[model samples]
Target: MTLYYAPRTVSAAVAIALNEVGAPYETVKIDFASSDQTKPGYHKVNPKGRVPALITDRGVLTETSALLDYVAALYPKARLVPDDPFQAAQMRSVMTYLASTWHINHAMGGRGARWAYQQSSFDDLKSKVTENITANCRYFEDEVVQGPFVLGNQFTLADAYFYTVTTWLPSDGVDIADFPHLHAYQQRMQARASVQKAQSDGFF
Candidate 1:
């Protein structure tokens, strides 16, 4: 497997999951700073022109949630997903929220151009990031996170996904310290070997 990723992006979640499963893979850095993801060469790899495209033996896989699920399925012994159906659905629900809601909220701060053409509109979107992301953090604190992990006690793929998104909190103008549960969750996730490996590898 070969993982194409950009630092400080949600792509880090996939790298952490691969490491958690002890999967052997090489990483190709997609330098978003240089517009590498938009180049034709990369477009051939992923027509969406985005990072976190994984080249597996079967085919290329994009999207963080799908890739995480693939990794968990490939290495069931890693138990990156819950065995119970309801718990598994709960895990997917959180991952979906991260991808569809929380991440979009954060993107508006910097990627506002994707949504609007007007400068004033960009500013409006940027202004809302702090409030939107803080609300997301609050939701995770009061409703989402069950305990030590997203599902409590057991470390699953959702942790990798949640941890990566949470890393954006400080830059999104929200302090992790404002949410004790999430702050502690961040600390615990940082201590994990998979996360340490992802960080050391420059996945962020």
Candidate 2:
């Protein structure tokens, strides 16, 4: 069994992806609010002190992107990652876009907002983040097919990660109303059985 340390929200996507594969795993919630990540013993599990670290039979896996891929590969019959080379590439691209692009934007935007709250002039930086996020949102909005998932009709890990991050838009002051397709995608993703199970299991 795998030991998953996830703090409810950010880690929800990975938890859902694992559930999508029907893999057996044990989950341990890390309370980020109380600085549980920085606690003394936790570092040994993940030196970076981050949430969603998976302690598998092989070893400890950090980074959601890596963890998702690892778990998906463990259950090929689930088809969480496409079999076709091109479709697999597209799925990976979407996952990378979510992990590196959108996730980074959120980290920076949150910091900028905090700086602004501290009387720092983060206006310019925040504006740029907003613009970048909007551009991505628009791109996804226009690019996502009317199918049920991110990579067409198949439910891949990309959709799970996208749903997790895109939900942060409102808090970051991003109005996704203009991105109808993306919004619809978000709604559809949240309704998935794996997603719902992940949520119920508190895999965040």
Give me the candidate number with maximum TM-score.
1
Q: Candidate 2: worst 10 consecutive residues by lDDT?
A: 113-122
lDDT of residue 156 for candidate 1: 98
Candidates in order, TM-scores: namely 0.99, 0.86
RMSD per model, one decimal: 0.6, 2.9
Model 1 spans > 4 angstroms off: none
Question: Considering summed lDDT, which 10 consecutive residues are worst modelled in model 1?
Answer: 144-153
Candidate of highest lDDT? 1
Give candidate 1's TM-score.
0.99
lDDT of each: 0.95, 0.76
Report clash pairs, candidate 2. Answer: 8-204
30 Cα displacement, candidate 2 (Å)? 1.5
lDDT of 1 at 187: 95
Query: How well is each residue in 1-204 modelled by candidate 1, as lDDT tens digits?
Result: 999999999999999999999999999998888999999999999999987999999999999999999999999999999999999999999999999999999999998989999999999999999999999999999999987999998999999999999999888999999999999999999999999999999987
Name the lDDT value of residue 18 in candidate 2: 77
